[model samples]
Target: MSKINKKSMGQFFTPPQIADRLVQLLEQQVGFALDLGCGRGQLGKSILKRFPLARYVGIEKDREHFNHCANLLTEQTIICADVLEEKALSLISDFMPVDTVVGNPPFLEIPISNHLVLEVKDAIPNFLSSGYKMRSEMLFFAKSLKQLKLGGQASFILPKTFFISEQYRYFREHIIDNFSNISLFELPSRIFSGAEVSTCILYFNYRKTKNQQLTLGCIDANGDIENYLKIDSAAAVTRMDFSYHRLMSESGIRIEESETIGSIGGLIHRGNMSRNELVRKSVPHFHTTSFPINEIEISLDDDVKDGIRFGQEGDILLARVGTRCLDRQVLVTAGKRAITDCIYTIKLPEADIDTVIASLSSKYGKLWRQINAKGSCAKYLTKESLLNMPLFN
Candidate 1:
């Protein structure tokens, strides 16, 4: 497929092996199956091969893919319509309360137009509040759940961020509260040929029951099971709230509980300087960068004083942005310096700044920051998230 068409339509066909694996994870007696964003019907073909009698429906937005799916799976129903549209959802709703739902939904971050946003609100009123920015895959999950019957099950190939990123916090909470038999399979990175995004397969049944625990596992490139861990549902939810690093880490070592940076007499906050104000003041504004920051002399006017994040000699500066958060570039200043909003200033008294920096720069500290940071492309750690970091004595 042309790159332009693929990008515009969010059409990334599932690999045959992965498709078979996802289908195998579903119930053998699946009465009816619906594949949302069923690009070229790879998943549908897998499902039919497993259960020949299974009533299958596939929804594809791209006309070319829809035509291809129609030809490939002539026995099944294939609809060419936007999955987010009310009309399309209505068509699927006709197959209401499907027993099994599965697919790799499109992953896109484009803003939903106001008109389409209203359509989503009307269709799945309680899915998410209006005006909340969310990825296209999340909408697919919500709609899938809405279409599923009680005791129904679903397995979706989702970006790893769905389990950890703050943007999906509420969705994670919803899954924890509402779903049962939850299983997470952490697939190795680059499972998709051209896609760089890390992915995990989420399997859950739409039922309410107590004594719920999650089964977590990792699979290699060839789909071999590596290791598995069973964790209490509540514990899994808590870890996901902070970061998935500990839960998803191959090491599988539990993070030792310790006092947070806030409890250790460290004050953490973001820089508050405005660009216009900082430009005129000529202050040495430190941003999250790989290169060293050059010092710039600034006349400390009252306005500039209020804007610049002035750091003391012993204070630690860390990048608050994604991936960069793991860099653990905790700068122990030789003297007071001007910092920018991209960096977080940590003021610690009575504690050795060097010792703290060393600990945070360790493997454990890197994992902690990775989990706490938010966002997919521009990940970052909020002040509250940074303050919650475990401090070593």
Candidate 2:
């Protein structure tokens, strides 16, 4: 494919080495594998090289790549069509009882309605349908699974955010519900070609299992696997409880009647200012995209003037919605600029905003993990959830 066409399709061809590594992982899992979004058949060719007799099905929407190598493998079939197309399902079924499904699908922004970029929505059926959306490259994982048999397996490279992101909570929940074994190989930002998108390789085992425990492993950018993190049948519920307990304990605060002095609603207001406009008006606007709080340079532009301003002295700024990690409550007692709308401004009465800023910089604030819960790049912090965030009075 020409460079321009590939860029338009968001096709970042996987290097032979990376494709080989991913295919090697799948080779260890199953015999028959389906490569969704199989651009140029890089991954499919690698699969055939290792498993010479492997039943490989390479699905590509691009006509250029599909027609070039129709008969490259010993037992591989290349299908050229939209994956979301209804006819694609039948073709996939023909390869039924698939052992492994793998691919690196396109990644893009969320769609509000039927106004999506193309057939990308078909990648993850339930995400947009359930009112949850984000920029995801892992859609191949969810879609490819539909083509697999009961005890099939899947592997794919997806954006790294899926592991720690809150918008992906439902995505994570879905994986846990459907598959029993899920292993993740986290890579640093420099792994992929033409794209610095931080990503991970997810290994999914789709046994005839029902809500089985999952095994998770965190891999570094250089391909070093850390210890595996396992979760049993009750992983979801247990994770929630552990998260709450860990967050509360870090604050050195207990949930008690006496401890509840007043809700955050009394002190915090959703800060409002356009991100681009804020940048035009001022250099720093207590923004999530630019300044995520942990590394904001102390300046005059972030301080509030008189009432409900973006950056102001003694104003605590919290990202109300965006990626889960950035939803953190940040304090800007020194900057003089205004905050963007994505952030909420906390103005306390006779309070030390500096202390609040200090508190947010602590491990307790990091444990909240709510600020980074919504958006694709950044998990958005919901307004309601941030209101309930633990804060020391």
Q: What is the C-alpha RMSD of each candidate to the true structure, in Å?
A: 5.5, 6.4
In candidate 1, list every pair of residues with a backbone clash. Answer: 322-379
TM-score to native of every candidate shown: 0.77, 0.66
Taking all chains together, the TM-score of candidate 2 against the true structure is: 0.66
Question: What TM-score does model 1 achieve against the real structure?
Answer: 0.77
Model 2 agreement with the true structure over 1-393: per-residue lDDT tens digits? 665666556677777777776776662545788887787888888777887777788877878778764755535688888764557757767667587788888765443345342333453444533354545354456567667777776778876566554555666666666666566665544565655555667776675367565555545544455445455545443232223444554466755531211352236666656778656655455566555445633545534445445546666665666543363555554646766677776665544444456555667655564422444334455555444555553
- Quick one: how many clashes does candidate 1 have? 1
What candidate 2 gets wrong by more than 4 Å, as runs, is: 1-8, 15-18, 27-29, 67-75, 89-94, 109-143, 158-171, 196-199, 208-212, 237-313, 317-344, 348-355, 363-393
lDDT of 2 at 150: 75
